[model samples]
Target: MTADPIDQALFPPFDDAAGFDRIRADLGAFLPAIRAVCERHGLAASGLAAFERGTNVVVSNDAGQIIKLFPPFLRHQFEAERLALGRVHGNVPVATPEILREGELDGWPYLVMSRLPGRTLEEVWPALGGAERAEALARIGEIMTAAHALPTGGLESLDLGWDAFVERQIAGCEGRHRRMRLPERLIAQIPAYLASARPLLPTSVIPVLLTGEYTPENLLVTQTGGAWRVTGMIDFADACLGPAEYDLLGPCLFLAAGSAELQRAFLVACGTGIADADLTPALSRKLMALALLHRYSNLGYQVRIEGWESQASSLSALEQLIWPFPVR
Candidate 1:
């Protein structure tokens, strides 16, 4: 019987440096294959760096070109990113890197893209204080608004409707929860939320531009002259077509100091359709709760499977909130 190529990559003993070394050795067999492709595409001279953080082998060079090798099992994800990038081309709110190469390297799916120009906004956010932070957030709202305004009409294959997005989220929760051996109760609650919140979900989600992962890691802010504008928005790996309100939640949860006022301003700028009066601590409460639930599910799976400890812990902290359940 033949083993699945992706399963092989997935089961690799990836731990710390020693495990990563073995993984790298395994990848070395495919390096030559990738090298040949890069050379053929005239990308031979690109400076190379490998970020062994996530599921894929994320590689980039000095030229700002990135090559993300998706595990054989995640071929669909590779296609999704490529498709989303294509949809946003020339229509993106801010400059986005161009996809240069997309195909398989040996048996692994790989995506090569020209690098966006700028530093991560995460690094910039800390330097600015109250007023500047407020102003930066407003700009952030504008960026999101611009992205949501992109025309989705006549683009069916690329369109990520609300139903599909909700289904994916539910599936994601179920998959991770099962993997982590998380409490069955939490998993059971998801269906209830989905059934009850289905109506509310669409109401909150005004379809515009949906970049699925709105985390700070994917955002790039560049300074031109003395003005700092959002120069590049990278990583369309999770980009989808969905509600604009859902999109603003990223900044609300991860950026914006988790402030109600800032969140209100963001919703307004992004044209999220949520009235200022609707902005309340209640919204933050939901974000905080959902954040924790996701963190627990992700971490539980990671820990149960002996996956990346740091990654699991990172996600665990993402949902930090006052919990009645004691930390075991």
Candidate 2:
């Protein structure tokens, strides 16, 4: 059986980063074909802008809808995202995009979702006062706590059970950091550190749906009553079933940016207690290990961490700098 021309045209091998860049640079070449697909499904394609942060072809249409098209290799992401949005609908306090339509177009899976309200949290973070930033972080913490409290019934469909996922990540922990060109000294210690910490890791717990990327970019905030509040939580493409701590990596490393006050507010809001002593060094180490093992934990891709170069001498130092727990 021959593949359809549209499928053949839209599909690109995942290994070719340059090829993906070329497609993004000249999105016009693919717009006509994408427009045809959207029109066939009764979605207007005008006002399309390629969402630059992601690897896939994601664009927002004039109708206040986001249409994300995934190549064959990334079809799992489409399925995971669709299932996540559906399962979390009406279950949490924050607004989540409603899946309007989902189907395969020329072998490329696409999902049309309602465009969420408010600007992304990252857009407003730099302009906020200390009080506003703290309030926003607390609100985010609350939202995350509520999200993690939801039942994980339908999430198993993603086939990423917690124990298996952790084991897999642990096995590849060293190699992944090595490939990311981590310093030789730190890379050498990763294996022993991870092995020693394996027993400390959670093997069994009530699994919660993990929004693997809980950074500011995925959180939408709006100013109301003279305070910043999280209005919506978007982008669950990397959602998985895992321990609650996994969700905190982004907020700690990226959003809070080593702010003790913000981290305290976040923890207090999450009902994890306000004392710095609450975040024990061992627990901090485990969470730090998980952060390093995160699927997208490549320093080359995370420009935000570049600012900490002077403070971080090794992986351990970097972890301590990003998530400083009081020394006993």
Candidate 3:
């Protein structure tokens, strides 16, 4: 039997120290061969630039299509993204890439998807004023609410069930933070804090599909009638079935950035009334603990939180640091 060409290509584990650098190098070396595969499938590569910002080797062309290639070791991400994009298409207001084709090329799994039109929110956020940012954040909140309301039937087959997933995170909370080099004071409080807050974790609310990273980078924005609005949501590789609050961590921590007004606008749009007391100290602590336990949580990569180090003396202080009350 002949070996698959993709199988013959050397690829590192997902967590290899060199990570995407190694993948990019290998992909560059194999570009001619990859381009041949695309040509065979009627996707022309002339004058097209490949976008390598993410872990995968992705290319888009004038034909309004995105071609994403995943190494065999990262096939799970391919499957998750393909399934998520298909499931969420047309069901939510915000646009999502539609899967046009999916298969393996020389052992590398690939998905060809329709291109979504809009600029990433991160690109436009800095120019917007406070009111404009708030409006966009509130619209994002509404989009998230709609996404969470979608049925989870298609995602049930994913490897980790919600309860077991939370349990795993709970068990690893302390060690995970330690590896991320979280402050010693915060690290020491994790175990007992999580133990006391376990009951408050979203076991009671009906589980919903969480697009784990809702930060500006994953959102697309465009001006509609002179107002900036979120037009599309992308990158479902981290999607999972979890509590809605767990999904809010990205927007709250990254987008709102302790702005009480922005946070209120977001929560109000999500239909969670904006009482200052709603995010009580206990609830805030629980959410912060859960933030640390999030699937992709790592303070090492979240350089924004470094600014709070001087103020995070206690849990209450940490909450204030991450989600301060609005100024009068």
The model with the greater lDDT, 1 or 3, is: 3
Local distance difference test, each candidate: 0.57, 0.74, 0.73
| Ranked candidates, highest lDDT first | 2, 3, 1
- After superposition, the stretches of candidate 1 with alpha carbons farther than 4 Å from their true spots are 1-30, 153-155, 158-161, 164-199, 203-208, 224-228, 281-328
Can you write out model 1's per-residue Cα lDDT over 93-148, one digit (the tens) per residue? 67877888776644667778887778877678667666665666677777776677
| Candidate 3 per-residue C-alpha lDDT over 1-328 given as tens digits, one digit per residue, 9 for 90 to 100 | 1124454443334465356556653545556645755665787676556775666777777788877777666777887887777778898878989887777766678787888889888889888899999988888888888888888786775435667888898888888888888888988887777777777676645678777657888898888888788888878877767677777788878778767777777766774443555755555666676777787777545525556877678655776777665434
Model 1 residue 57 lDDT? 67
Worst 10 residues of 3 by lDDT: 1-10
- Candidate 3 displacement at residue 205 in angstroms: 5.1
Q: How accurate is candidate 2 locally (lDDT)?
A: 0.74
Q: Mark the 10 consecutive residues where model 1 has the least summed lDDT.
A: 319-328
* Pairs with steric clashes in candidate 1: 47-61, 64-115, 148-208, 148-209, 180-301, 206-244, 292-319
Total backbone clashes of candidate 3, pairs 3 or more residues apart or in separate chains: 1
